[model samples]
Target: MPELPEVETVRRTLNELVTGKTISSVTVKLPRIIQRPAEPEVFAQALAGQTIESVERRGKFLRIRMNGLVMVSHLRMEGRYGVYQAHEPVELHTHVIFHFTDGTELRYKDVRQFGTMHLFQPGEELVQKPLMKLGIEPLSSEFTLKAMTDKLSRRTTKIKPLLLNQEYIVGLGNIYVDEALHSAGLHPERTADSLKPAEWKRLHEAIHETLERAVEAGGSSIKSYVNGQGEMGMFQHQLLVYGRKNEPCTRCGTPIDKFVVGGRGTHICSRCQRLPRVKKSSGEV
Candidate 1:
């Protein structure tokens, strides 16, 4: 799944590619992807003749702002966007196409068919489902150390899963969460509320620094993710431990290890992310 940095890259690229273009027509080959208006035709009708003002992102969701309408899209797994001329052939698995008056076409393709689209009135999107429950942006000034510590101190869940929860902190998926935890030298299995003040500060800084560098590098292309121009991200070169299992740690020479934590694949360097040994309840030893 494309996390914050990847989705933000898509938004930036798409904004440059499609903004100010009027939607002359819309074709929805996969009606199931449309989650609003109760009908695919209504979605097409609402977008027709409307000019896209800008493309913004809230967490992993893309908001394509148009005249009086906001199209909220979530590219779940393999969803991607591309801009092409009308004369180009429509590729297979292209579920949605927005034809522009300028003869350019914006196409949405999803191999897994898990992507979703919802349309809502301009201001209503923030007050409704999907966007309403999302937490603060990690890159924004609103994500202060105090805010992060306060939120984590209230949760008993393991730090990794807590970080993955969008209700607590948005834009952290499996990949980025692992990267952030590794960068902070914090164990994923640590209790959320058990961190010391210094640990919380390091973790907070790691989250922002990791995400900022990732967004600058266009996000890690660990899977099929790419920008609107179909370019793979460069941040994968800077990854510390997300997919580097069995490889020597960049800092310590300890072999990176992989394990299942909270039912998600996790990577870590045992030497770097050392955790306190837990006391056994009542052992026969």
Candidate 2:
């Protein structure tokens, strides 16, 4: 799944490619991918004749703003978007196509067929299902040290899963979570509430620094993720711990370890991120 950096890259590139273009028609070959208006033809008709005003992102969801409607799209695992000439042959797995007035088409392809699109009125989008429940954007100004610590204070769950929760901190997935924890020199198994103030501060800085660098590198292309231009990300080459299992740690010579945390494969440098001693309660063993 594409994390914040990857999603943000898609938003930037897609915005540049599609903004101001008018939708002449829409073809939804897979009706299940369209979740709004309760009907696929309604979605198709609603988008027709509307001009794409902008493309924005909330967490990992892509918001394609039109004249009066907003198309909220979630590109689940293995989903990608591309712009091509209408004369070009539609590739396999292309489930949705928005034909533009300029003889170009914006195509959505998902191998897993797990991608989703919801259409909502412009002002009502945030009040609806998916976007309404998302937490603060980590890259936004609203996500402060106090905000992060406040959210962390309420959880006894393992720090890795807590960070992965979209309700707690939107846009973090498995890859970035592992990378952020490794960057902060914190163990994935550490309890969220066990973090000290210093640890929280370190984590806050690490999250921003890691995400900024990844966005600069167009996000990690660990899987099939690519930008609107179909270019793979460069950040995977600079990864510190994620997907480096059994490889020597960049800081220490210790081999990186891999294990499941919160049901997701997690990577870490044991020497850099030592496990926190399990604390016992007064009545417990």
CA lDDT of each prediction against the hidden true structure: 0.93, 0.93
lDDT of 2 by residue, 1-285 (tens): 999999999999999999999999999999999988889999999989999999999999999999989999999998999999999999999999999999999999999999999999997999998899899899999889999988886688999989999998899999888888988999999998888989999999999999999999999898899999999999999998888889999999899999898889999999999996868989996
| Model 1 C-alpha lDDT versus the unseen true structure | 0.93
Candidate 2 lowest-lDDT run of ten: 149-158
TM-scores, all models, native as reference: 0.97, 0.97
Q: Worst 10-residue stretch by lDDT in candidate 1?
A: 276-285
- Superposed Cα deviation of residue 169, candidate 1 (Å): 0.5
- For model 2, which pairs clash? none
Q: Which tens-of-lDDT digit does each residue in 1-285 have in candidate 1? A: 999999999999999999999999999999999998779999999889999999999999999999889999999999999999999999999999999999999999999999999999999999998799999899989999998887787678899999999998999998888888888889999998778888888899999999999999999898899999999999999999988989999999999999999999999999999997877778645
Cα error of candidate 1 at position 25, Å: 0.8
